[model samples]
Structures are given as structure tokens and as C-alpha cells.
Target: MVFRIRPIIGDSFKRKERIGNRRARFSSLLALSKFDFEEEHEMNKQLDVHTDTESGLSGELNAAISRRRLLAAIGMSGAGMAAGALMSGGIGLAAPRGSVTEMVYGLSADCGSCVVPATIAELRVMTGTVTGTAFYVTDSGQEGHFYYDPGDTSSPDDTGLVLVSTAGYRFKRIYEGPVHVKWFGAKGDGSSDDTAAIQAAINGLAGGGVAFLPSSTYIVSSTVSIPYPNVKIMGSGSSTVIKAAAASNYETMISASGLSGIEIADLVVDANKANRTGLTVRTVAILLASCTDSSVDNCIVQNTIGGGGIPGVGIALGGVSVRCKVTGCILKDCGVAGKAADGVYTSGTQNLIMNCIALNCTDTGFVIEKSSLSGIIGCTAKQCGAGAAITNASAADVTGNFIDGLTIYDWSASNTGGIQIGTPNASLGALLNTRVSNVTMERVAGSGPSVYARQQGGKIIGLTLENIRINGAGTQGILFNATDILIANCHIYNTTNAGIQSQGACERVVIEGCYIYGGSFGIALTTGCTGCHIVGNVMIGITGQTNYGVYCFGTGTNINCIMNTIENVTVRKIGYDAGTLPNVFSSVNAGISTNATATATALGTLSRKFQIFDKDGGSIGFIPVYSTIT
Candidate 1:
């Protein structure tokens, strides 16, 4: 059917034919635009539509009415009353407020389903239903669309929609792109000071964004501070270098202080230790202070000098930082000082240091101090003064680390070891519940042990050392002064002192399933040890030396070493060869001495009886009652 639309007061009428199989279509004469209705049954017939020049229509313009008569009939009396009655049925001719029927203009081809709303309320209703669908807004002085999802309405202040646009969409919100350091006037020419320019670029990113560094060397005179949350500073792997201009002035090259959700990746930080002319204080390459959920990955930190009564550190995470990670980074020549220069030092709770390498550090390659529930995994420490140090830490796991060629620089007997766990001061508290597993140490040449655990001020409790291999250590292979400690599944060889030694007051220590060879003593318990269980251990003595398989002795004072059980231990080639090693088990003390000089009357009251056995499980003799111990 042909539909005729005429204004109630004007004499102009427009007739338009409906499309095939379509009943009627609504075209508003007020805007002179036609709306192709998809659902024709939803539209109401006999509705009085009003235009801009007319008040209302009296009668509907059907097939029987001409164009001029239709306008004249609508201009008769009672037209407004009839139109009011028709609008009372909720069939108001004007489209719902802000609903559009025209094509949106100036939209790109990639902008899908451009929705141009005449009012904001129409846009809000459309956005609520179009969840996960992107739309472009055009012809409304806006450049982008309002992206919406119902799940984002969890916050009371959230509008469930975010307006992303570059040309200042709704309320003049400009989209923030990546903030490059070069855009902020940073000259990365390896000469000028780009510290201020780099800092400005990071500061300009208010609510956190990427601060990209190009492939150029940036000379920084002072420490660059990353104070913003959720900010990432990315660089071109090793090509982008951040070198310290003055090494002695700053404590760290980059400092992330009290910030969370920060990431620093693919950068090289150089401390310039060789160029230290007026260097005074020690330096750290990267310092993460009280930062949580932060990461430093694929970065290189090198040449940190620690001298003149100062300790240098390559990377330090202190101030109780939580859940931070440092992975896939290389640290070299970190500690120039011979004592306290540590490559990666962490005192943060629940932090992770993995897949990192520390080369030629003076003091220690990695250190976990006063941190609880932290982990050091899959790291390599080579040619370091000490491989790793764990002190005053609880519930920490040190696993899968390869420590090789640990040497002594200044030659302090107390401070040299491949892996050392000691409480040097009382302020650091006790070290408890620490586990070391699958750690291999080779060529540990120093005046100290391969693995040393000493109690200077604090005691160690619940320590576990498992699956460890120590080859070629200068002094003792493993030394401990701990309570409730377990050392199992270990292979120790070529040590100057005993393979495993326990000094001081050690209680409830278990050493089982260990193989020891080439040491002065296989297992030695000295200085008042109690309730130690040495079971299922094999000790093989090297030729051309006097070595004891198991040695247990007490101090010359009143402290007695008692209640020690040694069972299923195999001792081979001690005195069987041409060496002058006395016995397999050497018990020398005032009370339990097996020496022939002690009189029978002196041994009767003080000495306790111990059964000695041969290789064929035959009872050889008793200690202090008979001459032979084993």
C-alpha cells in the first residue's frame, strides 16, 4: 500500500511506496527522514504524528484521501484534541528521545556498528545491552565509543563503561598512549644526563603506563626513582643501557620505593666501578624497597664496587618487600670488597629469585637474610667468595643452585665458605626451618667449609640439607651447629677437614644416607653434642693419610657428649691400608676415652661401654674395656 504523509497545517504531502512484503514504514516529516522498520507488527497504526510546522493530524491519510484534501481535513477543528487522544494510547509519533534513524557519518571502516545517539540516556541503554561489543560514536562531536560490560560495575563509582578516544571523547577525556623517554627530551647519547628527562616521562604517566626506552645508552648521574604504581619501564634488551655517571654518589642506580605492581625489564644497568675516581660510599645496582608484586626480569646489573668500609650489592630487596621476583638477570663483578659484597641480597618475605647468575662476587653470590618463606631457585654462582648465604631466615627454600670455584679473596677463616649460614649479630634473630635441596658445589677452595652453618648469636632449628654434593672443598665439607637438623642423601668428597662436622651444643641432629670420601674425618661430633643419629652412612678414606671414619669427643671441661647413636655406618680403608689411623670410631674424652693411658680404675666409673663390630657383623670388642674400638 502507498502511504501518504502530510502536515496538518501545510499543504505539502509526500507519498512513498512500501517495499515488498512490508505493510507500513514510519517517516518523520519533522526531520524529513525515513525509518525502515524491521518489525512492522510492533508499530501502532492510526497514530497522530506531529511535525515541526503542524500541531497534530485530525484523520489518518489513507488511500481515499488526496494530498490537498488530506492537509485541509487535518487543518479543521478538533485536530489537536484528536491527536491528544491518539498520543494517550502511548503511540506518540516522535521517536523515543535520542533514538536515531540516520546513518552515522565520518566513521572509519573498522568502526563496527557506529551508534549515534541524540542524547546520553539513549547511549546508556544501548551500552548496557551491547556488552563486549565495540561501537563507534559519530556525528555527536565524539571520536570514540563507550565500551561497556556489566561485570565492571562492581565498584559503586564505576559507570560500567569506559570512553576510549584520542580526539577527546566525552567530557574531553584524552587517551593516554605510551610515554616514551625520547618524547620528554631525553638525549640517550651516552654523554648527556637523561635523568631529568626520564624522570619527567615517568612522572607524566599519572595512573600507570609504559615508559619505553629506545636502544641507546642513557647516562644517569643519580638514582632513577620509580614511585608510581602499575608502571613498567621497558628497554631494548641489552642495547638500551642505563649507566651511572657518578658511581660513588648514589646508593643505587634504580630505586623502586614503596610501590606495587611495578615492572622493570630488558635493561642493562652499569655501576662503572672502574671509573671510580672520588668514590666513597658503596653502591647497589638495583634497590627495591618495600615494594610488593613487582618484577625485575631480563636485566643485567654489573660493576658494583664495595670498598672503603662500605659493602656493595648488585640487587637488594629490603624493608620487608613481599611477593617480588627477580628472574633471568645477570650480575657480574658485583662486590669489589672482600667481605660483605653480595650479588643478590633479599630480606623480603615470600619473594622469589630465580634463573639468575652471579659471577665473581666478593662476599656472597646470593643472600636471603631475615626473610620468611622466600625461595632461591635455578641460579648459578661462579667464582664468588661465597656461593650463597642464608641467615636469620625461616621457612626458606634454596634449591637447584650450582656453586662452583668459590675462592677466598681476603682469607678470613671464619668468613669463607661456598654456602654459609651464620648469625653474625644478635639483631638478626634466629635462623629456623630453612631447607636446602639439590645444591651442587664444586672446587670450593678457601680456608672455610663448603657448607657452613654456625651460630654466632642466634641458634638454628629445623634445618634440612638434602640432595647436596660437595666436591673438592678446602676445609670441612659440611659443618653445622644446629638443633633438629637433618642432612641426608649427600655426597661429599675431597675435603681438608672432616666431611661433616658438628660443633657446639647440637641436639637431635640426623645424618643419614650420605657418602663421604677423602677427608680427615668422615663424621665428627665435637664440643658437647647430644642425641645425634648417624645412620646408613658410608665413609671411604683416601690413601697416604691418617683419617678417621667417625670421631666423637667432648670438651676437656665438664661438658659431656652423650646419647649419640651410630648404626649401619660402613667405614673402609682407614687403618686397613698402610696409614697409621687408629680406629674407625675414635672416642677421646675424660669420660669416654678409648686411650690405653687411662687406667682401668679411671675408666670403670666414667666410661660407658660401646660395642664394636667387624665387616662381617662380628662383635670385636667394647670401647675403654678392650683395646680396639672397631
Candidate 2:
């Protein structure tokens, strides 16, 4: 009875195995490749005698010399150091799949990346409880993203740093504390002096904080109000920039009256000089009067003297600032004298402007006269001249703004009109309940699918427009006069004319779930339009090109092109392609009788059931949504 299997240089042993009677298994092998010393080294060196009937030939010569030394050490495998020690020994690496991978765990991928790995948990400092987790990269390219641990110890006292990003990161903190002001660079032409270091940080604030501007180039002058209350005047992110001095004078680089929880992140504010009317002029780059809880996120606000014209007001919020919030701000070129420049001139009332962005402005990209229940969300305006987006004398609550090119009043030197509500000198009367009522435009962006009302008898009631998307290759999405409208789920594409065009006098109107593809004329309802309701909308046609999806002219009465859906809409009942002639009180009921025989061989006409719908609602196929009309 003997047992032995050797190749143990500097011996080491431990063994156990059974199989049929219940238990079995043990393991150990360090260095034995060379195909197990040229194949099993003589049956593991003849397993020299040991006992229990040599334990089955010493366990089959120690398992064929550890399976030929693990297939000759699989070409010397180290498998990423055994997968970094089973991912730092949590065994087979599993956790981290949600909550932004359990709050940004590992994989340094490069510079300054840490999610706690003991430098004493990377500088831990918590009074009692320690609920730790962290993350924030959010497109961390351009050498940006950097968090502080400094070996934690609660980052130096008083329960400070509380970073909780992870909602895909929106960290633009731009300084939470510690950075006692000191930057001197771009003065020469940009203008310096910092007015005695901004009046010695507003008289050495004993309460409110922040006033950092590191990267330089800050030529400011005058109206820089700092009447305390959670003050902030930061920079550095856009690499610290602020230039305001184009002479014509009406100064205001930064102003805040009797502040209340304020904020003005990052920085830029270059009001391009030379008659830059109110360069950073006394109302707003970041102004909040009777301040409640203010904010002006990100930052840009440009117009540094271009055509000796930027009187195009940029940010002017007057007294009684309510929940003011201007997110992701950026206003460009601004009103080069074309007339009343405004990139944001509010009167503050329930203010909340989201994702703000405006380009080439002359007189509009957010200019609410006497702001009421304000809320202009998701804004963007390109080219812009007269009106790329406005609401004169109050009725503010324009939703999702995105105006495009905008040619301007067709060819009358001064006229852009893409979103203007009320103002032919307002006051159609009702004074106490005030003027300009509930205005809501969802998914808004227009060029054509129009809605331009000039007060004669002002009262825009409740205008709720869902999905009001217009591209305007031609014009008209919702153009009105004396309006009271409701346009639903609209999507007006291409266009040359008529998607929803009313001349004046529009009441109780509702155009539903629309989609007016390629227009030349889709829904015109002209002539003192009243009681309009065109439901489940959809209008197409643009191939060989011809128009008219729902056309009504002068002297309208309860205009209802009901439960609609027009595919190639070319039934121009009397005018349009064949010149112009047919115009009596147009009327059409439920449709699709070849649109009443193409309106009787082109307006020598006939009418009955005009373009069908309502087999139980919902069928916005062709697409012209006057707010889901039905």
C-alpha cells in the first residue's frame, strides 16, 4: 500500500477526493507548464508509494499532471491579472448596472477619476452617518470634469460638499465656495478697473458670498448692484469673460436690486460696443428686483457693438421677480436697431425660461411686455428680425419656442412677425381682469403654420396649441386677427401658404391633431372667421403641386371641416392654380366624395359631406392639427 506523485520542488501538499461515496475535490498548481515537463513527467515521477492502495494510482497521477499544466499555461495567461483580482474581490464582478452604475464606481479611463477606494475612503469626513456615493462626467471631454476629494475628511468641515449628480450629470456649479477673487488680464481694449474691485466685493460682504472671475478680461463699468442676499458673480467657465463698453451709454454689466437667493453662473456678457444702447443696459444680464428666488444659468448674452445698433435689449426683468429661472441661457447678436431689440425683456411674473437660446435678434426672441404668469420654455430663435417670438403688453406663457429663419414682414423694410400676440396699441378693454389671457403653445416653432394677432378687441383667451411644429417653406400655420384659438397636435411641414390661416375674427376655434404636409394652401378659413372647428386633421399634396385642404373664404359661419383627412388635397374650388374667381361663403361637411367632385369641376361647385372623419375619433393621418379640431 503506497502512494506518491511528485514534482513539488520545495514541497507543498494537501489532498482530498472521493466521487461515488459522497465527497471529493481539492486544488493547487503553481508553475508546471512546458506541457507538464514534456507530458506528465513520467506519470508524475512514478507516484512513489504511500497508502490506501496508493489512492487510485495517486489520483490518476495527480490528474494528468494538472491537465498538461493547464494546456501549457494557455500561452502564459494572466487574464488582466485575473480580471483585476475578480474586480477587487467581490468575486465574479456583478454590481453596477443602474443608478449610473452604482454612482460612478471605476475604470479610471484617465485623469482624476475616483469613486472612493480608501485613501481612507479617499478622504472621508462625515460627522455621524456616512452614506457615500459619487459621479459626474457628463461629456467630460475638453478637460473639464473634476471633483474634489482631497481625501474627504468631509472636505474640510461644517458638513460641506454634497454632490448628487447622476441624472446624467448637469453639474455647472461654477464655484460653491472658497475662491477669494483675484484675476487681472484683459483690460487694454476690453476695459478694466473692476471699479475698485467691484466696490470691494460690495463693501466686503459679511453675509452673502461668491465673486470669483479668474481667467480675466473683465472691463466693467457702473450699474453693478450688489445689495446683498445670496450674491454671486462668477466666471472662469467660459474661461472668464465680460466686456461691456461701446460708448453710447446706458450702463449695466450686472445689477441686482435687494437680492433674494440669487445666482449667475459661468459668464460672457460681451455687449459689442459702439452705440450698443445700454451695453448691458440697466435692466438685465442678470437682474431681479423685489427678488424672490432668482437664477440665470449658464451664460453668454452677446452684442458687443456690431452695426452701432444693438439696442436690441437683452435680459430686462423689472420688479417683483417671482420664481425667476432662466436656464441654459445664450442670447446672440441682438436687435441691431431694426426697432425695439429684445432677447429677454420681461416684467417678471411666474418667470421660468428653459433652455434659452436666441440668435440674430432685432426686436424679439422673448419680449413679454407686462409679463403675466410667465413661462417661456425650451426656447430657440434663429435669424430673427421684427418678431421671432413675442407677446406684447402681456399674455405670456409661450411654450417650447423654436422660431427659424423668418424673412420679416415680406418686403416692407421692417416686418418679421413669426410669433406676435396682441398689440396694435392694446387696450381693447377689460382692465381689471387685466389684458392678455392664458397663452400656451406646445412644441412651438413657427415660420408659417401661423398665429399672429394684433389687438383690435384684445382677448386671446385660452390658446392651447399642442405639437405646433411649422417649417414654412412658404407661410401660414396659424395667422389670426381678433383671436380665440385652440390648435392641437399640429405638425405643419414644407408650406407656401395655408395650414391654418384666418384673416381676423376667430372664435372658439379648435383644429385638432394636425399634420399639413407640403402646403400651398391647406386650411384658409378667411374673412372674419368665426366658430371654426376642423377635427382630426391631416392634409397632403405637393407632387405636381396644387393646394387647398380645407379652404373657407369671407363671411364665414360655424366653419366646420369636420373629422378631416385629406391626402393629396388639390381640390382648389375656384382659384389657386386656375387663377382666381370662386369666393362665396364656403362650406363643407363630412368629406371625400372626391371632395364633392373636386368642388364641382373646380368651383362652378357642389357640396355635401366634404372630407369625412369620425368613425369614433383618432385618425390624424393626413395631418393639419388645429388643436385636434373635433
Candidate 3:
């Protein structure tokens, strides 16, 4: 039982309101004053209140009050409505039945005088049967797509309902989706120039609407920008391809600027990098400039150039974007050398870059710099000049990041970078509390290490590297210069110098449960290092030039070595030379002694035990650091 406040009269009620040039008569309002209480009571008595059909609202309405009382109350309410309408301008027009109508086929060009004569692809405009006063275009896709002359200044109540002066206007399915490009006369064939049609389809949508592309190849010569917020452009997986036309000089295929909730996904973008030119111009397949809460997912963007904004990116969330993502995309052959190009570049806060593959990029494969609380997960960068590069470029120190599940391979021999966090001479803020785990970096023909964390100005505090595998490097397998670091459960091999090396001053370094092999030095700490705990690590099989297994040059104090295994080294296992050494030193593993002649092994403060202080805070014996007796 659909409950509606309709007058109980044989003649329907009507209510009329002027909508721009057209009008709507609600019909039910005009019959309100003619409703009779006795007539309504008679009609309600025959409703069969005991027979519960669907809603069972009859039982509720019938039992709540007597039919005579209910009908009398409705009659009084109807009289009040009539009095109110008379007070407000008065209902003067003759109520026509229904001014709205739907039609299957389109209308002819000369159907009405004031209706637009343009061709109607689907729904046709109809002339008003009653003296050409009312106008309506019924059929449209997505329930609310509209067509109007751009010169019409007055805004209508509904976007779909634009009633002009007459009813002869032809209906055009302006692009709106769930807005499909096909509805806006975009021929997705390879030869056609679908730039204007696709652009109009995007512009037709209101905010927070989606524009969909079916499985077809759409060729375009210019850029298509999404200027509205909360708009999405989607495609039918890989079969929906957007390819650049021959000699297309557009800087970008698709772009959006400072819009939120914007997404570009499920499409194949072929930038035609071979035919594309302009070495000085930056090129991209999809660029989301300074847009927040956006993403580009499940896309294949290839043959793109980088030269536009320092580092050309296949899909970029540029200029301090926040909470954006680029996932499941394959970016290849982007950026020429010295142009600062990259795949999936984002300079934002709290963004996510995951499961993307960047191959053969001329510069960095993936770069997420100047970001806070952002991460790159399960991404691979292969055969690029640089791979998986990131740094904190801001002045204020920030923290909380995870670089996990990243695999980088075959960094260029000329470039000294692979999975790098911070440069040695960078004038930036500290990247603190960062974790790099489950990562694999390999360089078969290169001079640089697999992983490098070198910060010059601001310190990298509280860094953790675990479950990592680094193979074949030039100097060290991992160049670690961060403070308060932990390198645990890692396998590093085949380096010219040490497996894990720290050049400059570092503090509180811990190397735990790691396998270090085929390098000259297993763990090398040089100059101004302090508070190192080398524990439970297996260092064996020194390759190339035979050197000490674990070397420490100038550890100021407190360098503890416990349960560390070393073998196959002619030099001393644990070597510490030079620097100040006046405190208690302990016997370490078998390696090179301090210097050539091996005087007393001096390890500034190799305190294997802790001191137990008395309650009086004086004269307490030390609690031995290492529990080897057990």
C-alpha cells in the first residue's frame, strides 16, 4: 500500500510551478478543495483491511483510528492546504494532466519551433500537445544527462530537466556515466581524432562522477585534462588503449590539477616514445599535479619521455601532494639521461607507491622525495640508471616510513645508487624512524653498493634493515651511515670492501644474526664510531683481496662483540687500530690486530659486562657484559 496525500476526488489534484520558460502542473493539488470526508470514508471501508497483502500498512492505519475520524481529519487538512495556496499568489492555471512523456525513438529536425534542431542520437524532443507551452526530453543515459545551449544563463532546478521556450529541441546525449565516451560521439577507432569528443565527455559530468571507456583504441593528438574534483576516468582493463597520434606534440596525454578523489585506472597508455620528440620538453602519460586523495592503478604506461618538471614521471602526484597512490602500473623506457626523469614519481606526504614495475628508465626508476610517513612497497626497478631513490628534502626533521619488499637489479655502472635513502651531501632534514625490510638489491656490473643510506647534514636516526639480500657490489654491499641502526637477518656478499661499511661517525650500530661472505671485510666501522654491538653474525670465506673479517678503526668506546663466528681469513678476525684506547679491551675473533706488529689490542671500551651500582651510588663492581661462561 503506497501511502500518498492525494485528494479523494474522481478528478485528480494539480499543483503548478513555473520552471524557467517551461511549467509543471502537479495535478493532485488542484483537486484538494473538492475532497469530501463521507466519500473518503466510503472508499476506505472497501479497502479490505483484514486482508494483508504486501505492506500490511492497511492493518496499522485501519486499527489506529476509526475510518470516519481519519477521513474527517484528512478533509480538514486539505481545506487548510487550499487556504494556504490562496494566500500565496493563488493557483490560477487550468491543470493539465501530465506534461512529461517518454518516447522510444528520436524526434525529427523540424518537430518544434523553439527546440534545438541539432541531431538527437537517442531520445527525441517532442512538441507540447497543448499549444506548445510544456517541453520535455524523456530518454537519457545515466538517468540525468542533459543538453543545453551554452548561452542559456539561467540555471535550471535539475541538470537533466532543461525546458526551453518550445518543445521541438532535439535531444543530445551529452557525455555523463557511469559518463561513457561513446554516448558523446567519440569514435574509438585508431584513425579518428577523439580529443574533443573525449574532453567534452569528461566536462559533462558533475563532481564525484565517473567517465567510463569501453574496450577500444582511442587515438588523440592533444591533452585531455580533468578539471573537476572527485571525477574518475576508467577503462576496460588493458583492452582500452589510449595511444598518442603521430607527431603529437602534447606534453601530457591526460592531466589533472589540484583535484581530490581523482583516479585514472585500468588503461594502456602507449606514448609512442620512438616517434615522440622534444628533448627539452617533459612528457608523461598521466600527470596528476598537486592532487590529493587520488590514484593511478592497473595501468601500463610505456615509451614516455621525461623533461617537463625536472624528473619526468609516467604518473606523478607532484607538488606536495598528500595521501595519493600509484599501484600495479608498469612504467618502461621513460626519461633520457641527465633529464631527471622517473617512473611513478611522487613528492607528497603519507602517499603509497606499491606493486609498480619501472624498467630501463634513464634516470631514477622510482623517486618519492620530500615525503612524510609515505612508503614504497613490493615495487621493482630493473636496469635503470638509478633505482628506487628517495630522500627527505624538507628542512624540518620528519619520521615514520617503511621501504619494504622492494627488488632493484643491475644499477648502471656509472651511477652509484640502488635503493638509496639519502645522499651523503644532501642538505635536508633527517629521515628518522624508517624501516627497510624484505628488500633485495643486486648489481652485477657496478661500482656502487646495493643499498646506501648516507646523510651528511641531518642525521638518519633509528633506521632498521632486516631480511635483506645484497649481492655483487663495488665497495660495500651496504653503505650504512645512519645513527641508531639495526641490520639484522641479512645475507650480503661479493663486495670489494666490507660487506657492511660505515665511513663517517655513527652511533649505536647493531649488526645481529647476519651472514656476511665473499667480501674483504665482513663489517667495517671507521672513524668516530661508537656503541657498536656485533652479535651472533657468521662471517666466512673472504674473496678477492684477503683482509680482516671485522674491522673497527676509531670506535670511541663501548664496542661489544658477542657470539660472532669468523673463518677463512688469514688476517685477524676482529681488528681495531688507531684512535684513543685507554679503557678495558677484550679478546675478539681471529682477524688482523691493531696494526702490523700487533701491540696490545686496543678497543677504546670493549665492555663485555655491565656495572652493578650500589644504592649509595658509589664503589660497585661491574656486571660482566658478555655471559660467555654459561
Query: TM-score per candidate, in order?
Result: 0.61, 0.30, 0.68
2 versus 3: better lDDT goes to = 3
Write one digit per residue (lDDT tens) for candidate 3, span 118-164.
Answer: 22333333342322221223223222222333344453322232333
| Candidate 1, 168-195: lDDT as tens digits | 2321111223445764567799998988
Candidate 3 residue runs with Cα over 4 Å from true position:
1-176, 338-340, 413-416, 423-426, 543-545, 554-556, 580-630
Superposed model 1: Cα runs more than 4 Å off:
1-177, 246-248, 337-340, 393-414, 555-630
Query: Model 2, range 262-327, lDDT digits (tens) per residue?
Result: 777777777554445543333234456657677877888876222334344566566657677777
Question: What is the alpha-carbon lDDT for the whole of candidate 3?
Answer: 0.65
Ranking of all candidate structures by their lDDT, best first: 3, 1, 2
Candidate 2: RMSD to truth: 25.3
Give all candidates' CA lDDT scores: 0.60, 0.47, 0.65
The lDDT of model 1 is: 0.60
Q: Model 1 residue 393 lDDT?
A: 37
